[model samples]
Target chain A: MTYCVAMKLDSGMVFASDSRTNAGIDNISKFGKMRVFTRVGQRVIVTLSAGNLSITQSALNLLEQRARTNPDALGIWNAISLYDIAGLLGEAMREVKNRDGEFLRQNNIDASASFIVGGQIAGETQRLFQVYSEGNFIEASLETPYFQIGEIKYGKPIIDRILTPATDLTEATQCTLVSFDSTMRSNVSVGLPIDLLVYRNDSLSVDIQQRIEDGDPYFSQLATRWSEGLRGVFVNLPKPDWLTPKI
Target chain B: MTYCVAMKLDSGMVFASDSRTNAGIDNISKFGKMRVFTRVGQRVIVTLSAGNLSITQSALNLLEQRARTNPDALGIWNAISLYDIAGLLGEAMREVKNRDGEFLRQNNIDASASFIVGGQIAGETQRLFQVYSEGNFIEASLETPYFQIGEIKYGKPIIDRILTPATDLTEATQCTLVSFDSTMRSNVSVGLPIDLLVYRNDSLSVDIQQRIEDGDPYFSQLATRWSEGLRGVFVNLPKPDWLTPKI
Candidate 1:
């Protein structure tokens, strides 16, 4: 299981993904799922991947190979728009599917994956897209403002209640981490060593990236404070006043 | 779509359920899912049903008819333990399956249902059980003191974070409402008019039953306060320090 969330606020974009993969309970291990593509001052594309690790890794490898061999080809760095880069990523996914989808189907494993791709090209505004396994995609708008992939339900209510297009970049990052903490606490398959990246709109450069593991003091403080705050609220709600008398 | 939760704590028991049913998106309706059976000084058994409303309703009707015809013949009122009542409910479920399971399966509707049954007998302590469609059930022991059925994942994180056997009955009820509110906010299929039943340990009667509807002042107040409290916490959490020095 994986949990990755990305938000496109008016100020910037925020991306966070957990680093846990498991074929089964006994075979769990760490694998970071955030990939950064940049051609400094030209374009910066950040993607969060979830689902069958082999499929995602192969698709990513295909994308990297294309970037290296074919500079004039439609690649993330050279794409005219974020939409075009999303299309290129979808093309890579289909290529990987052609290579390995049949073998996975033969073994009864579904050839499935989901990706959240968000960043900016040199001439375009910052944008975000959720790419599906079928090589189709949808872009986020002001109304939706965010995209989440994998193990989403346990953490959805908070995001639905707290985030909006008007939210600031730093506040959006805080909300994303709180959402991740809720998911990580409820699920064993989503473990620590989280990757978070913040992209300031129109910067076309990458710098604000942090890798958080257990014992990270800042995350530790936020998690503890949130828990204690909830407990306090739970203790303060009014009890039932409708307990009628029974004969 | 439904959200029903039951908790067995040292102080007593708490049950909360939403009251919305829909065959499809266009045919949604309201129906009570919580049923109460009380023999006043002898036994009190409350059952909350979810999934395949027809199957559960038929099962409950069968149990009611059996009690009418022969009050002493394995009725909930005279069952020896809460466990016996859970078995009785399971038996009723199997009987319903035997009668209509084939027709429903042919029509492409599953003959599946889930029930949360709990209360106390005269000599027994408070107990809780979750009965399955196959007429088998599991009890909530000290290790895991709660059970939820239907549309569970959206509401699960809060309960997982806050509930324990040592939690007081009133606090347990508050937590259950919070859980239900979260589910309701995330899903339009699960709606209002919540049914809440509170049983103090060793009180072999029903008194603390509240049918909370939309516009109930106390519930409305609690819900508003909880939402505000969460937003407050989200705003207060410290922003990432590592975001500094971005180019």
Candidate 2:
């Protein structure tokens, strides 16, 4: 199980991903799920993945191998637009499926993997897309400012309440962390260290990419403050007076 | 789909269930998932169910019929302890499975159902049990004060943050509503016209059982207030100040 989310906001895009992966509880391991492809002044692409780690890793490794061996061949750095980059990533996923899908099916394992690919090319606006297991993809729009993959429900309510196309990058980043905090508390499958990246619109380069661990000071403070704030608000809300006597 | 949760607190118990049932998204209908069995001066048993409405309704109907015709047949009213009532409910589930499971399986349908039963019997302390599709059940303890069935994840974080053995009945009731509200907002499958029941220990009767509708003034106000409160708290929290502009 995993939890990864990306938001395309007015100011920029925010991406967050949990690092835990497990075939079973006893097989749990930490693997960084965020990949950054940067070409200094030309483009910056961030990809967050979830599902069968082997499949995602294989697809990613194939993409990285292409970039290293043949920079012009379906590499994130060489893609002209975010859509082209999404297509290239999808092609990579399909390549992996062709190679490993049959073996996984024979072993009764699903050849499942998904990804959120978002970034900006030198001349294009920042955009985000959610890539499916079959390599199909959907881009975020005004109506849906955010996309979440894996164990999404526990952390969704907050995003649904607060996210919009006009939301600022900083607020969206905070909201994403709060969302991750909520999920981390309720679900053991989604653990730290969290990979968080914020891209400023039109920067065409990585802005802030930080790792949040279990004892990270800022995250710890945010969690405590959020919990206290909720309790305070809860107490302040008016109790149903009609049920007072009965209760 | 349905969402029903029941909690056993030190002070008493709380049970809440949404009233939506759907064969498919377009075939949605309203059906109460909660049933109250109270032989007034004797026992007050509340059962909240979720999944496969037909199967759950059949199980409840069977329990009701048994209690009506064979008054001494170890029904909820005749059960000496809450544990006995739980056993009776589990047996009812098994009976329904025996009658319908094969036919359902043949049609490629799952005979899925779950229940949360909580109440006070004349002689024992208030108790709560979560009964599964297999007719097996587990009781809630001090460490885990609540049990939720069907579309549960969207509403789980709030309960995880707030529920405790010492939480008062009113606070617990409020927490449950907030949780349900979150679930409803995130999931179209779980909807309005929620049924909320509150029981006070040794009261020997329902303290409050209310149906909250879509336009219910109090609920609408609570929802708006909570949303505003959350936004306010979020804005006040410190933003990540990690990235400084290069000199």
Candidate 3:
């Protein structure tokens, strides 16, 4: 289980992913789920993955192999647009499926992996896309400016309430972290050592790619403050007076 | 799809269930998922259900039918303990499965249903139980005071934050409604016309059982106030300073 969220705000994009993975309650491990591909000032592509770790890692390795052996081929570094990056990623997924799908199916493990690919490529606009197990993808639009993969529901209410196309990057980033915090608090499968990246549109480079651990000052402060704020609001709401006499 | 939540607090118990049922999106209809059985001043039993409406309705009908026929069998009204009522409901579920399981399975539909049953029976303490499709049930303990069924995730965060054994009946009731409101906002399958039941410990008969529709004054007020309150909290939280620099 993992939780990754990416927002395509008017100002830029925000990507966050949790690092914990578990086969069951007893077998848990920490692994980085966010992969960054960048050519400094030319392009930056962030991919957050969830599902079978082996499959996803294999797919990533295959993509990197392509980039190394054939830089001029359609790999992440050379992809002209975010859509092309998504396609190349999808192609990598299919390649993995062709190689491992039958063996995994025989062992009753579905050849599964999904990703959120978002960032800027040289000439195109910043965009976010959610890639599916089938290697198909859908880009975020103005109406739905964010995409969430993995344990999404526990953290979705806050995002649904506060995010919009016009939301500033600062607020969106805060909201994403808060969303991650809420999810982590409720679900043990999603844990610390979060990978957070913020990209300012047209920069064509990684902006703020920080690793947030258990005691990161800003994240800790924001989480504690938000929880307290929620409690305060909860208490301030008028109690259902009608319930007094009835129950 | 349906959403129902129930909590057993030291003060009493709270049960809330949405009234939407759908065979498909186009075939959606309204039916109360909550059923109340009360022998005034003696006992009150509330059952909130989710899943195949036909199966749950059949199970409830069987329980009621047995009460009418045998009277001394494990009928809710005759049960001496809340656990007995849960057992009776679970037995009823098995009966439904025995009767309809083959036909449903042949059609490739799951003979699935789950219930949150809570109340006070004469001579026994107040209790809550979550009954499963297999006619098995588990009682809520102090550590986990609440149970939710059907489309549960969207509304889970509020309960995780607010519910505790010491939470007062009024606060628990409000929290349950807010949880339902969050779920209803995000899911089309779970809608208005909610059935909310509140039970006070020791006082067997229901304290309040209200039918809350889309325009019910108190609920409408709470919904509006909650949304505004959440937005207010979002704005009040200090934005991460990092993104501001990028912008």
Candidate 4:
């Protein structure tokens, strides 16, 4: 399982994805799911994918091959808009599935994969899109400024409460990590070594990118402090007056 | 859809269930999912249900009729332990499914249902059990102190963070309400009025019972206060120093 969240805030964009893949419990392995495409100072496209590793890897490989072999092919690096890049990624997914999906189905393995594709091009504002397994997609808007894919439910309530279009990059990153922490605690399939990238709007390049593994100082402090703060808040929440019986 | 949660705590037990049901988006209605059976000062058995409402209702009706018509039939009131009552409930579920499963399947509707049965008889200690649709059940223990059914994932994180066998009844109730609040916020299928019951361990009778509808004062206060408190904690979370460029 994967838990990747991306927010298209007014200030910038925040992307985080876990690095765990498993064919089954015994065959679990670490595979970073964040794919970064950049033409430095021109465009930066980040894709976080979930589902069958083979399918997603194949789809990404196809996109990368296209960009590298043919610069004028209108792929990730040269796309006019984030929306066009998202379309290319979805088409790549269909191409890969059409090649391998039948073989996977014969072996009773699910062949579907999805992606949270978001970033900025030279002329366009930062945008976020979640591409479905069927090669269809939807873009995030002001009303829904964030998109989460894979193992989303356990960590959804917090994001639903704290995120908005006007939220700053730093705060959105904090919220995304908190959401990841909640997910990792509840589910074993979503493990550590998160790939995090923060894109300041209009920069047209990536600045802050780090892989967060176990015992990272700031993440550790934030997680422990958040837990402690929640317990503190819970203890102070007023006990229902009706819980006590009049003697 | 429905959301019901029950915890087996050392101080007693807490059961809370939403009152919303829907055949489809346009066919939503309110029907209390909680049923209480008490032989005052002797036994208090509570059943909270989820899944196909018709199947669960029919199963409960069968149990009620059996207990009422034949005092010597060894039904819920005279069951040796809560375990026996859980088995009875599971058996009732199987009977109802066997009767209605064919028709529902023909129409492509699910015929499955489940129940969280908990409480005590005169000779037994407090207990909780989650009866599955297959007529199998598992009892809650010190390690696993709670059970939730239907629309459960959105509300699961808070309970995972806070609930324990050692938690007091009031605190457990608060946690359950917070969980319900999270669920209702994220999904429209689960909503008020919530039927809440708190049972004091070994009392063998229920004292506090309330149908908390919309505009209920304490619930409203808690929900609003919880959201505010979470925002407070999020702001206080320290931003990573790495986010800043060394000037």
Candidate 5:
């Protein structure tokens, strides 16, 4: 299980992913689930994956191999638009699924995986997409300005409350980390260090990519303060008038 | 889909359930999921249900008929402890599954269902149990003092943050509603009017059973204030020092 979230705001985009993966409770390990691709001044594409490690690793390996061996051919590096990049990712996922889906399914394993891929590509506006295991995708819209993959529900409420297309990059970063904190608390499978990247719209370069390890001062402070603040707010909320008297 | 949660605290117990039921997105209806049985001053047992509506309704019907038709049959009404009540409920559920499970399975429908049953019988202290589809059940312990059934993840973080065995009944009730609020906001399948009941320790009577209808004043106020307070806390948190300067 993993928890990854990405937001495409008017000011920029934010991407975050946890580094925990488990085959079972006793067979847990750490793996970075985010991939960053950069062509400074031209493109800055970030991808956060969730699902079978083998399948995503295979898909990512295929993309990287294509870029390395055939730079002249169309690949993530030369894709004219973010849509093309998402399509390439979807194709890679489908290729891997076609190869591995049956073997895993025979053993009653889930072969499905998903990715939140988004960034700017020189000529167009920054866009975000949630690519499915079936080689299809949907872009985020004003009505839904973010995409989340894997162990997503525990962290969803806060994102639903705070994020919008107009949210600033820094505030969105704060919200995303708080979301991760809530997820890490409720679920042990999603642990630190968190890989986070904040992209400024039109910058076409990765400026802030921070890995929040255990005991990292700022993340520790933010988690503690968010928890304290939530409690403070809850205790101060007006109790039900009827129940308050009885208590 | 549904969202139902029940908590057993040192002060008492709190139970809540959303009323939305759907065969599919287009085939939606409302049915209260919380049922209370009270023999004032002697016993007060509450049951919250989730999963196949037909199965739970049939099981509840079976329990009601047994208690009404044969008082000497050791039914819910005569159960010596809340555990006995939970067992009776489980037996009824098993009977329903035996009758309905095969047919539902033949059509590829899920026959599983679960219940959170709790209350106090005369000589016993209040206890809570989560009865599974197979009729086996587990009692809530001091460490895990609550049970949630159906669409649970979105609302779980707040409860994990605030609840403890020592939490008071009013605060638990408040916490429960906020959880429901979070679930309802994120998943439309779980909706109001919410059915909520608060039971005080050793009080063998139903004191607070609230149906938070759409536009219910207190719930509306709580939801509004909570959203505002969360945003307030979020903005006030110290931004990550490194990112703050860049933004």
Candidate 6:
């Protein structure tokens, strides 16, 4: 299982993904699930993936190979819109499904994948999409300014509560980390070494692509302070009056 | 969908369930999912259900009818151990499955139900069981002192962060409410008018059963304060140093 969340806020877009991938309780490994593609002044596209590691790898490999084969081809760098980039990703996964879906189905493995592709396209605004394995996608709107793929629920409440279209880039970054912290705390399958990137609107370069590992002071303090602060807030909240003994 | 959570703490046990039930977005209704059965001095059994409404209702009806028809029968009150009571509830569900499972399956409806049955029996300490659709159940242990059924993940992180075997009843009650608040905040399928029951250790009766209706002052205040407190804590958490524009 994996947890990846991306926010298309007013100031920019934020992306975060945990590195822990597991086949079972004992079979766990660290694999970066976030992919960054930047064309300096043209675009900065980030993609986060979840589901069937083999399929994810295959799809990503195909996308990279496509870019390497023809720099001016149908890859993300040449896509006309951010939505087009998402469709390209979906098409890559669909190609993988065409190749491996049947073999996996024969073995009872579901050939499924989920992705969050978000960023800007030169003159266009920041956009985000949650692409399904079926090669279809939907763009984020003001009403829903975020997209999350994979083990999303444990971290959803905080994002639902704290983030909005009007959130700033830095604040949304912090909120994204807190959301990942909540997820990692609850699920052992989503461990440390996080890929966090913040795309400031119109900044067609990926400068804040921080691959945060465990014990990073800033992240450690942020996680510890968030937990302690939540405890303090929880303890200070009103206790159950109905349970108090009546005199 | 539904949200039900039960905590087995050193001070006692706490159970809570939201009232919203929906087959789909269009078919929404409110129904109390928590049922409390008590023999004042002998036992206090609270059961919370999350699954096919017909199956759960049928199972509860069976348990009720069995107890009323034969006081000495294998009913909740007559059960020897808390485990037996859980088994009895499981048996009731199994009976429902046997009666309706095939018909429902024929119609493509999965005849499944999940339950959290927890309370104290005569000469027994407080116990909690998460009864699955198959009627088999697992007892909550010190390491895993809580069980959540239906839409569990959104509200899971809070309880996982706060509750422990050493937590007190009132604190656990507060924690459960906060958990429900998070669930309701994120998922519209889980709505208001919560059923909250606090079972004190060794007290074989139901005294603190609060059917908290929407706009109930205490609940309203708690929810508001909690939301505000969380926002405050979130804002105060240390921001990411990597994202701050140098100096």
**TM-score winner among the candidates?**
5
State candidate 4's TM-score: 0.96
Give the clashing pairs for model 2: none
For candidate 1 chain B, the 10 contiguous residues with the lowest summed lDDT are B238-247
Give the runs in model 1 whose Cα sits over 4 Å from its true position: A243-247, B70-73, B98-111, B244-247
lDDT of 1 by residue, A129-195 (tens): 9999888999999899999999998889989998999888778888888899899988989979999
Q: How many clashes in each candidate?
A: 0, 0, 1, 0, 0, 0
Point out the worst 10-residue segment of candidate 4 chain A by lDDT. Answer: A238-247
lDDT of 5 by residue, A1-247 (tens): 8999999898999999999999988999999999999989999999999999999999999999999999998899888899999999999999999999999999998888999999999999999999987879999999999999999999999999999888888889999999999999889999998999999988999979999999999999998999999999999988898898876
Give a tens-digit lDDT track for model 1, residues B149-169. Answer: 999988998898899899877
Q: After superposing candidate 6, which stretches have Cα over 4 Å from the reference? A: A70-73
* Best model number under DockQ: 5
Q: Per-residue lDDT of B1-247 in model 6, one digit per residue for the tens?
A: 8999999888788899999988879999999999988888898888999999899988999999888889887887688788998998898999889988998898898677899999988887888999999999999998999999988998999898888899888788888988988998889899889998877788777758788887888888998998899899988988776678721
Q: Indicate the residue-level lDDT of A134 in model 3.
A: 90
For model 2, residues B90-171, the per-residue Cα lDDT tens digits are 8888999899999999998868999999899888888999999888899998899999999999999989988999999988
Query: Which 10-residue span in candidate 2 chain A carries the lowest summed lDDT?
Result: A71-80
The per-model DockQ list reads 0.56, 0.63, 0.71, 0.60, 0.83, 0.67
Instruction: Give the alpha carbon lDDT tens digit for every residue of A1-247 in model 2.
Output: 8999999988888899999999989999999999998887898899999998988998988888878899767676677899987888888899998998999999999789999999888888888999999999999998998899988988899999989988887778889999999999999989999999988888877888899998999998888999999988888876876577777
Better of 3 and 4 by DockQ: 3
Residue-level lDDT for B84 in candidate 3: 83
Q: Candidate 6 lDDT, tens digit per residue, A160-217? A: 8898899888789889998998988888899889998877877777768888888989
Clashing pairs in 5: none
The candidate maximizing lDDT is 5
Task: State the lDDT of candidate 3 residue by residue for A1-247, as single tens digits.
Answer: 9999999988899999999998878999999999998887788889999988888898899989888998887776677788987887888888888988999899898678899999988778888999998999999999999999999988998899899999988888889988998898889899999999988888878889888888888889888888888888888777777777665
Worst 10 residues of 6 chain A by lDDT: A238-247
Q: Which sections of candidate 3 miss by over 4 Å? A: none
Q: Which window of ten consecutive residues has the lowest lDDT sum in model 4 chain B?
A: B238-247
